[model samples]
Structure formats: structure tokens, C-alpha cells
Target: MTQDIWTLIVVILVFLGILALMIRGWRNRTRSQAGLFDSLPEVPAETGEVVLGPLTGVYIGSTVAGDWQARIARAPLGHRSAGTLTAFTGGLRLDLADATVWIPRSDLQTVRRASALANKTVPGGGILVARWQVDGPDGTTEIDSGFRADDKDTYPRWEALRGDAAPTTRPDTPSSTTEENK
Candidate 1:
């Protein structure tokens, strides 16, 4: 009985040690990724009316604009969450369970379909990636935020909007889907 109890305790301690190491590593990564994170712009008040959809999906993650391998380590921005994407005149709003992020059209660079991000990978063109600019610790930095929509077909419609020259007003939806223009 005594030997069994000691073995159980040792196993628990090892698992606890691993957990601590993970937390430490995450913190270190966040601290070192100075230029990778920036304060997200607040969503506009009028954005309450979703022009397109609150498309359900997972917020895969974001990385430095053109660097796929360098994962961002900022909270909410770096963290993965079940998310929704909505279109508004101001820009595309990504709502994660943890927080709401606004990607203003003015800051938008382009919209593209991709297969992978830093921590997640899908088929050849499964991800809807939005490239935009944000004020960063090192001035303005471009970021690529990936969202994998529940309805994969929606990607073509979204990609058609021309986010590189994002419109000043919410553009008309190409057509409808299970998700309405909320």
C-alpha cells in the first residue's frame, strides 16, 4: 500500500511539472513576440447590424503578415477559439468567445484562401485568411488572421469582396447562405 501511494504521488508530480513547463513556455513565447502583437481596434457602434454573416467557425490563429511559421502569442489574438465572422461597413468583425476583434476595411490589405496557419492545417484552401494592418510595438505591422468557416462554400463569396481595396461601405452579399445577413 505504501509503495503504491508513493508511485501515484510521483506520477502526479510529473504531470504537474509538465503543466508548469507548458505555461512557462507560453509566457516566454508571448514575451518574445513583441512585434507580433498589437491592440485590436474597438468594433464600431453601428457594427451591431451584421451586413453579412456571423459565420460560425474556429479562429485558427494569426501570424506575422507573411510568415506562416511564426505564430502570434498575444492573448485572444494568439489563442484559438470557436469564432464567428461578420461583415460591416467599417470592416470584418471576428468574434471569438473570449473577445471581439475589429478589422477595419481601411486597414485591410487583402483576403485570401489558405491551407494552413501556425498551429492548424487544413485541405488546400480551407482557411479564409484576412490580411490587415495594425499598430504594433514596432509601428504598423501586417497580420494574417485565419478563420475556417463552418460552410466552406462561403469562402468564394468572401474572397470575392476584394478586401485588398476594401470598400468604404458594406458591400452587398453575393447571395445568401444558411447564415443570413444578421
Candidate 2:
């Protein structure tokens, strides 16, 4: 009888532990999602120098200026880049590449020296924003997306791309392949 009671106690403890773990996981997920939205600041139209936090993943679309438009030609990371960004309505996964760079959306923290602040009409209209290009270990990828001040939700995507965990700064020296390419 005593052994059965001990077994019951152990089972109860195990169940309680599992319940606690599940609650903790839910809380963390909620916090992370909330942080994604709360981190963005309101950008003004006239703001010129907007700095961006790390990007969750580099965009893979092409730039469009006036009549010309660019689309994502190829994604080495797969059909989509392995990252997340804030879209006009909600959050979106930035899946444009094949190698799948895992940039967590919660990393973008700030934006500075951005030209988009002065151009209020640039979000859905106006000149195409500058093309964002990133050279990774395999090859280079480019995206034709512009930063929007009104969409603060994108901060998490930006953070994930440019967070401290990103590649370390390299010296000004060019790589041997770069020298050859030149």
C-alpha cells in the first residue's frame, strides 16, 4: 500500500511539472509576439536618417522606380527566405531564398538614416525603395522592398536580419574571389 502511494505521488509530481512547462512555453511565445509589435517607433514623414534594426531576413524582390519594376528572380534559400516580417496587416514569413537564413523577427531594435520618412507616398506608391542586398556564404541575394514608418510591426523582421548574432564585421580588404571578380 505504501509503495502504491509513493507511485501516485510521483505521477502527480510529473503531471504538475509538465503542466508548468506548458504554461511557461505559452507565456514565452506570447511575450515574443508582443515584443515584435511593441518594438517599432513611429516614423515621421520628414525623418531622413532612419536606422533599421537587424532584419529577420533580407528581402528577395526587385526594385521598381517609376515605370520599371523588379520581381524576385531566384531564391537560393528555397521558395522563401527563412525569416519573418510585418506586412501591411499582420506578420509574414520572408521566404525568398533556398538556404533559409533563420532570422528571428524579434531582433530588429532600431532604424536610423532612412530616406523613407520624408516620402509619405512611398509605402504603396512613389519611387521604389532602395534594393537591399546581402552576400552570404553561398552567393548574393537582393530584395526590392522599402522600409515603411507606419508599419512598425516589421521591426522584428529587421531585427532578425541585423541582430548582434549576424556576421562579424570584416576588414576593408577584399576577398580573393572579389579580387578575381574585379
| Top model number, lDDT | 1
Whole-model lDDT per candidate: 0.75, 0.33
Stretches off by above 4 angstroms in model 1 are 1-8, 34-38, 48-51, 164-182
Q: Which stretches of candidate 2 lie over 4 Å from their true place?
A: 1-92, 95-102, 105-113, 116-135, 138-162, 170-182
Residue-wise C-alpha lDDT for candidate 1, range 29-125, written one tens digit per residue: 8998776445688887775455678799999898865566567888778888999998876789998998998888878877788877766778777
Question: What RMSD, rounded to one decimal, does every model reach?
Answer: 9.0, 17.8
Model 1 root-mean-square deviation: 9.0
- Model 2 clash count equals 35
Assess the local accuracy of residue 181 in candidate 2 as a C-alpha lDDT between 0 and 100. 23
What TM-score does each of the candidates earn? Answer: 0.79, 0.22
